[model samples]
Target: MGNFAKGYSMKDRQFWVIVMSLGGASVFVFAAMYSVQPLLPFFTEQFQISVSYASLSMSMTTLSIIIGLMVLGFLSDRYGRLPFVRFSILLTIIPFLLMPLTDSFAVIIFLRFIQGFAIAGVPAAALAYISEEIHPQSMGLATALYISCNALGGTIGRLMMGYLTENKSWEIAFLCLAFFGSIIFILVWLTLPKSRNFTIHRRFIREDLYGFWLHLKNPYLLLLFGFGIILQLSFTGMWSFIPYYLVEPPFLLSLKMISFIFLAYGLGIIGSPIANALANKVGIAKIRTIGVLLLVGGILCTVSTSLALIVVGLCIACLGFFTTHSLTSATVSRTASHQKGLASSLYLVSYYIGVAAGSTLLSPIWLHFKWHGIVIITVLLPIIYLFFLNYTLHKKMP
Candidate 1:
């Protein structure tokens, strides 16, 4: 309940409460958004659809989230952050409950889209909330912790769905996720503090539009936003197709085994906080560059036929991806001089657009080139972007 002028620090009980609540809520949000990833092949089999078509289940959700982030982020700036955060979790449960009852693939995709839009509320507001409410000294760690939970949630969801689908059914997997979401919702409601630092922007629609335009016009901010797109495009593209790749050829891993691969995401949980701490010492740019290099290197390692190497590569990839992501996101929150909610939303909009594109747009690469093709494109894209990012930052700094 405390919202001091200096914001909550590590020593405060309220600080832990807020961080844990938001972190828990983030876990549910990301888990619901990404749980369908491991089940793409199952959907392909169940619906008798193409691999690309089954990917729509993942893409459609992220696509809807893009739209939701813009609208909800704008609204949160006008109203409040806490409401959208609360409402997002509540809305997320509905689709999980509904998806299991339907037989049609179209219906399932539509529900997933709704669920993705609902999931947007948290990212749109939560980062902005942390920037406004948490003490600056602790904000880096706080953001990293929240993002780490995001990784944890995605890992849990994929693992849970993969396990349940293999043993029981995909339907049971979704229902179980819904039940888990309800538990997260209750914890969030009880523990989340009201925002003390948020100042309502009651301005007209035109003014808000201008604020968005200003953010878009800032070259530095645009670079960060583009970085978000590149980071997720490669990361999501890698994960989206791995299940299919492992289920084929010499590897031929089962869905249950494939789910365990997400344990690499545990590296992401550790990577964020560590990267944030290092960025404080070596500089964010240096850490981010290292992160991108790690990402590229890890993707290349997957070319090895050895199963152990593939898993090791994935661990490296997860670490790099989360490190870059956590730093970029925290920087975005700090860079915007005003309308932090809108700025955070724009970053995520670009971020999830990468998710949608990686899931669906890369289908052709998967189709024609297979895993090798995927490796080429995913690796190349980030490297190309990293050069661009460094060059841009270097020019701007002097």
Candidate 2:
């Protein structure tokens, strides 16, 4: 285990190793989760399914994550953090490695479910671990860095999958993912220090159960959880249809060009900490409101025919999503200090529930009304969510 001396916490060798390893793990986890998104159009053509059915590939994974987060979140609170997190990373690798061997879409979707279940260990445990281990003064920055890594991972994974699948095959994309994923897996397994702050406890005890109950009852946390769900639903629903939108009609963009569009996710890396800093001055409620407005504005811009305006809109939407996500995620822990792991799990439960629903539901709308219908669905949620957030903050703060 790494030393916990003052020198070690203050940007020493061990601290950097821990941060870098966690960041690498963040990249791998999201990459594995979202890499399939860019392949949705190909899935439709190959499987002879509608856009709605093709979306099942991504939806199934997120739905599975909901189950995993629920189970692992509570279990991690009882068991130590390191074991669950390590096991999660290791187990997630199996599905990706196996992806190349499958031709059946059903089998592939099933594997994605298993992969989501495995990766649940990361988010369910990582935030709790960071809060437990990182020094209080640097915790915000550490968490922001992790969020940045997530954004980068997502961007890289989508671009890599889209490009490789365009040039070679989807199987080739999965193989490349397996290769890089394994290396990052080993780095995290070797470098992430064992938990310095966790106290192992018996599972399902009365006190622990009561702690979870209290978190569920807290009005502030419930509001934040609602906000998370709405944000993810809007964000994921919009993205789930992008490849389909660009591949047809007026755009006719290749998979490579569509992949390049996801590079907009890079804005999240800048948005995460900037939102966090602004939250300190303007407060979480106002910042969240602003984020919702930006997101709505971006969605409106996508209705334009111009490619340049669409890309600009995508960047704005990504920033808004990350800004809201970073603040809300941090607040989950703060709202339930005694049940941080459980609270984190619940927040993710809400987030993924939104994702699964949005991906599946919005696609059918796309099938009917096309992009205009999608824009209608995407733009409405954040406006309503922003108003709700304002009311909640007023009630709680007053």
Candidate 3:
């Protein structure tokens, strides 16, 4: 047994192992996903491509992530969580190792798409695993910790890579990811205990398709999906463009200096658990409204060129977004009667749909409005989500 696997002595082995292994497991997702964002301008400058064209690195991974979230999440329902989780982790490592070997933008994008697909295992399976295996009282903390790993990894990876890129080639950043992912791979293999809530079944495409369709047919399910979309569109649009905004006029921040901004991501790690605890006390619907309002307020504050204002605003925004995401994700996992894999899948579909659509629409927005336009463009979804959250609060349903 791994040191982590042996340390936590919950009878529900899957639950505690998941809590422990998430730091290692989430590196697969974050290392694969956000590792490239810091390198976007590097690619544009080196390749002599337009900024819009270089943005494809961000776009391709998200587009592929949509396919992974839907397909992988659904398959976990029929085949079982452990197999899907392990298979996805093992497969994802290949693209990380291969990414640094390429010079061609086309090949790198292709590899990034594949990397996105392979890394869907931990997040989708972790959610279903929590809902199924953990006691209801304990699920909130477990979910919060798991999500905190994601936020922490994202912040650290981007900042580390951004600093590294200042001193080395972009290839060095991807290569570093490949090395770290290898260690995480071994840890995940050891630390992910076999799931008790698992049952294997025949894979029937038609029946499973019908199950997913029925799952999505609910108004409440659709509501969750809409919130997921809002969360993604708002969060990703800001993240994808923030480095660009900072490096350009007025701010003119260095890569190392801008990396300091990612320290705001640590607020997400803090906000996740606090938000869940607040939800437990005050109700998720009510807490979620507060979260969205904080997000809007933070974005409004970030429009300034003042360094302190930008840092504070980004910190507040990260907290709000992370809290909102925590509540929404936990709700999706808990609301389902069965086929949580499918429910998780449906939620992620909306999530990644926002990711794809957000990137696609950025071309026109960046052309016309730049960073402010991106903020205004993405803000509407959250604004509408506030209305839905108000409706949910009045009704007081899960």
Candidate 4:
């Protein structure tokens, strides 16, 4: 824990401002990142690309964020969090503004690449800021509140874009989102509190690299990190392609109707908190297993051709995704003896790598095998995940 001066309370004006500003920043980060999700179909048609090729629009961003996180994670440590937070929001604005101007698929992907690197600053700083500056008692609630904003942002971005694309051009949809993001960027700049707990340090890259290697060497942390990958792999893979599956074949839904289906992500906001509560009634280990089972079960449900069942399956899968993610994130934070920030960064890197892998690599499976192939591969991941998680429990954390 970083220095938290006495008399600093969650009830204070600064505390609420900090929380709200961070939440607003979260809305920008996730909203910008996920805005393209609903537009993938439109991109495919306009660019005349295959489903697997169209996925580059999303995958490239995620991969760039992985690169950004590695670099920015260290830079934030040296420069403090506030500057990075502000700088990131500002940099992300460029991509949003320029995205609609170009009709070229390559141009859009390039912009998303910039957006990914710019947006990485938010997550890189948010957690460390909250944990260091806020009251220890309030940290959990504050973190949960920020994540809720993330979930809501993702849902709103997809819904708004999906709905707008139904009536207006995709360009109009992106331009409007850019405008909204600019407003949030202003709010964060004006209101976000200056960092009080972080001390800037100019550490060598070799030292940071060694720290990363040491964290990876921890058996338990390594297990949790891998768990992060598996969770995102399954979740992102499903969401990315589900739009394709729905728009075509047996259950043909309009963009507006499919946007409503993404409302299922709202279930994710509740899932983590509910799972946290139930962890008291049921043990954490058992709860984690249940979350994985829910993921597998959700996938199995979607294997059906029934439209109603597919929607239900998506909702169930999202619940599992959020719950398991919350638990594993908490576990990683608790298990680390020091340098929790570095460990968390690595865990997130693993998570996004999963996303990048799932959306890109798994699309080929869909091309070759369709829905059955996607389900079959996703369902198997959770079982392998179970083995790693169980072995981690027995292995013990240092």
Evaluated at residue 307, the lDDT of candidate 4 is 83
Cα lDDT of model 1 by residue, 247-271, tens digit: 9989988899999998888899998
- Report the alpha-carbon TM-score of model 4 versus the true structure: 0.95
Clashing pairs in 1: none
In order, the Cα lDDT scores of the candidates are: 0.90, 0.84, 0.76, 0.84
Residue 127 local lDDT, model 2: 75
Writing each residue's lDDT as its tens digit, candidate 2 over 35-105 gives 88888998899878777777888899998889988778778878867777777878878887888897788
The reply for model 3, stretches above 4 Å from the true place, is: 1-15, 388-398
* Model 2: colliding residue pairs: none
How do all the candidates rank in terms of lDDT, highest first? 1, 4, 2, 3
lDDT of 3 at 259: 70
Residue pairs in steric clash, candidate 4? Answer: none
Angstrom error at residue 381, model 1: 0.7
Clashes of 3: 0
Candidate 2 segments exceeding 4 Å error: 1-8, 203-207, 395-397
Candidate 3 lDDT over residue span 1-398, tens digit each: 22232232345565576787765677557756777776666777777877777778777887787788777776776777777667776777687677778778888889878888887776767677665656665666777888898888888778877887887866777677777777777777787766765656686788778878887787777788888887877777777777888889998887778777888888988888999888879988788888887887777777898979988988888898988988888788788776676777788778877776665557678778888898786676698777966678458653
Report per-prediction Cα RMSD to one decimal.
1.4, 2.0, 3.4, 2.2
Clashes of each: 0, 0, 0, 0
Q: Which candidate is the best by TM-score?
A: 1
